[model samples]
Target: MKRDPDFPLVRNLVITLFATNGHLIDMGNRLVRPAGLTTAWWQVMGALGYAPAPLTVAQIARNMGLTRQGVQRVVDLLAARGYVALEPNPHHQRARLVALTAHGRAALEAAEGAAAAVDQRIIERIGTERLATALAVLGEMRDLILEELAQSATPSNDPTLSIENEE
Candidate 1:
């Protein structure tokens, strides 16, 4: 079968995006580590902090585009450390609401300050305009990818989706 002429360009873009994501995650981990947070922990905490009210583990997972079990693990860890508190959910009997405690809020604020410093450094190196353009392009790419996924009938585990052709 003949491949689309644009396939190579798309493939290269995907590879670059993956590499960039890794670098960004590494930077995030470094920035938040001093605050006693990993990138995943920071992300979950940020989501809860920004929300109007507390959220269940499943709700936080959905907001962060992660698995419930993954979010649950982090929530449990945070709870154990007194960074977050689990409250009885009026809406659900089993799923408790998770809220940031004073300690969690303080940690998140510290992490945000550290992140802001990193952002300033990056902005100085890249310029705000270029960074804005890059963000816009990334958002467009994400939307296009979502659209493609919505339209695609191919099974996620299909061998044809693999980088290397399978026999």
Candidate 2:
């Protein structure tokens, strides 16, 4: 079978993206550790901090591009640590809204402060123009992938694109 000419390039891009994500997470964990928070904890708290109001676990998961169960675990841990509070959701009875408490906000702020310094170092090393270009490329890639996902049908709808066949 003739391979699609772009397959190799796309595969390389995906491999690089995955590796980059792992590296970023490791760096994020280190940066947030001083605030007694892991990357996952900081991410959830940051989402809450930036939001106009409280959000449900599902909402947070969707926004973060994570699984609901994974986000739920993080929310539970945050609540147990007094970093967040779960309140009654007027919009949904079962799905309570999660909000950052004062403690959570402080921790998130500390994490951001730490990250700001690292961000500056990165900018110094990579330069603003190069970083901006990289950001634009990544944003475009993400948008295109999201569009493809939205339009995708089930595997049964396209056997040629099935997991087994793709592999």
Candidate 3:
């Protein structure tokens, strides 16, 4: 909490005030745009790509900290655009399942490769040690923030913002 010993209470408050979403939105946009996806679509693709089994919109929302309605919107868009296909949920007859299409899987694979390339380039430029250190710090900070948010009993904060936590 003591970011700087010399800085006083108001300075700490200023830092805490900056613990919001604007910079993250900008970062996510920059990271996803080169792969020809928005933050939302990329997140949906990633969720489907990585899940052990097909997920319902509600299930995806639970995992991704999204609202059911919000995830349903993404599912609808993905399905309409042929990025995901719906099947009957095995766990619930009344519920539907969402999974990636062949095209969607291909797109996600390519996007992941592109993202890796950019990550490597940044690491190379920054030097691996510095990059690793930064990653460690960011990962820890993200976990701490998410844990704090969840402790407040608001686990589902945003849909488009599901990150891996660098674990």
Candidate 4:
């Protein structure tokens, strides 16, 4: 396959993104540890906290770009700890809506507080404009990747969509 001229740069970007994700998750785990929450648990709780209403496991998974099974496991653990409550979904009979309890809100707030200093430090070092630009670029890249994923998942007659073609 003839590689794109920017392939190397794109490869480096992807590698950096993967490494950064790992580092961020590690940092999040450390920050949230005092609240008795792992990074995964914190993420799930954050999703619930940000939502306008309680969400089903499947809905949370979709919003977080996670597998439903994985979110289900986290939700189960959260519920067992009394951090979250699962109520019947009005729309779906089986998929229960997961809502953060008062305890869960406190835990999430603690995690956010712990991370606030780190976030401020990062912003101070990186500058708000640069961070904003980076965020926009990352959002664009994510959208493009999602488009590719959706296209690949669907049956297509277009030859350009073949694996042998350059991305």
Candidate 5:
């Protein structure tokens, strides 16, 4: 079989990225689960660790680029496991804020050691310096492209006008 040169290259790129990320998460989860954690848990922990301030589901979702419901489920599980605490949101009385509990902090600390092991393995598999540079470049490009797409997709001042991708 022959393939067209312009055969939806973007689709192939998206699939490759997702598959690689899923495998990486699998490795992380392997390291975390033994310490009573999941890949989802790490996402929340990383966000809170990045900024200790309590964040609402919506806020964390935006920051993590995940759906609000997706984060809510993770928060619910974390709370049930006593790894996280649910607090009233000061900014929005109706919204609940998610914060890491003492247990969560301890768990995260333990997980960090495991994370280092995973990091070392990955670095050895893929050159440490090369992977670091590739990750930075990919992140920057993803952000820039998303920003451009968002801007272009926004409705124009004129009614009944909006830019979009056409097949």
Candidate 6:
């Protein structure tokens, strides 16, 4: 079948995005390793740190755009390691609030300090203006992809509604 000219560009972008994601995750793992945290653990901790208050596993999942089950597993592990504590939620009977322990906060700060040097190196290589532009473009692309996903989830009457096949 004949493909649109833009297909190659989009395909390359998707491949590059995945490759970049893998590299970033690997870097994150290395940076957080000294703090006894994995990339996943750091991500959960970061979400909690950014939140105004302690959040439930489900809330963390939503904030991180991940699944509740996956977030819950990470929370359980963190809680076991004393990095976080689970307290009864007054609003929800079953959904307990997850809060970072003092140890967790300290570890997170250490990890951030360790990561700052690496981040500075990256910024110096890329330049602040270029990095800002890249960030904006990535944010826009993410929003567009999310909108497409939402549209795809809704039932439609047209059979040829798939964006992939659109001209």
The clash count for each model shown is 0, 0, 0, 0, 0, 0
C-alpha TM-score for every candidate:
0.75, 0.81, 0.61, 0.88, 0.75, 0.81
Q: What digit string (tens of lDDT, one per residue) describes model 4 on residues 1-167?
A: 99999899989999999999999999999999989999999999999999999998877887888877798899999999999998987776777789999999999999999999999999999999999999999989989988897777633765534654311
TM-score of 2: 0.81
Better of 3 and 5 by lDDT: 5
TM value for model 3 = 0.61
RMSD of 3: 7.3
Write down the RMSD of all candidates, one decimal each: 7.4, 6.3, 7.3, 6.5, 6.8, 7.2
Taking the tens digit of each residue's C-alpha lDDT, what string does model 3 give over 1-167? 64776668656645764763566456656776776666788887899899988888877886776777787897898888888999987667766889899988987887777578766777789998887896797667668777987676532764434542210
Clashing pairs in 4: none
User: What does the lDDT read for residue 96 in candidate 5?
Assistant: 77
RMSD of 5: 6.8
Residues 1-167 of candidate 6: C-alpha lDDT, one tens digit per residue? 99997899888988999999899889999999998999999999999887899998878886677877798899999999999999999977777899999999988888898799999998999999999998898889889987886677643654434553222
**Candidate 6 wrong stretches, greater than 4 Å:** 1-4, 154-167
Root-mean-square deviation of Cα positions for candidate 4 versus the true structure, in angstroms: 6.5
lDDT of 5 by residue, 1-167 (tens): 79788778767767988999999789879988988999888888778767769888777877888877798899899899998898987667666788898999888887888889767777999997899897897798689876985677646553323322110
Please report, as a residue range, the 10-residue window in candidate 1 with the lowest summed lDDT.
Answer: 158-167
Over 4 Å off, model 1:
1-4, 143-167
By TM-score, the better pick of 2 and 4 is: 4
Two-way TM-score contest, 5 vs 6, winner? 6
Mark the regions of model 5 whose C-alpha exceeds 4 Å error after superposition. 1-13, 124-128, 152-167
Q: How many clashes show up in model 1?
A: 0
State residue 82's C-alpha deviation in candidate 6, in Å. 1.2
Give per-residue CA lDDT, model 1, range 23-62, as digits (tens).
9889989999999999888998999999999999978976
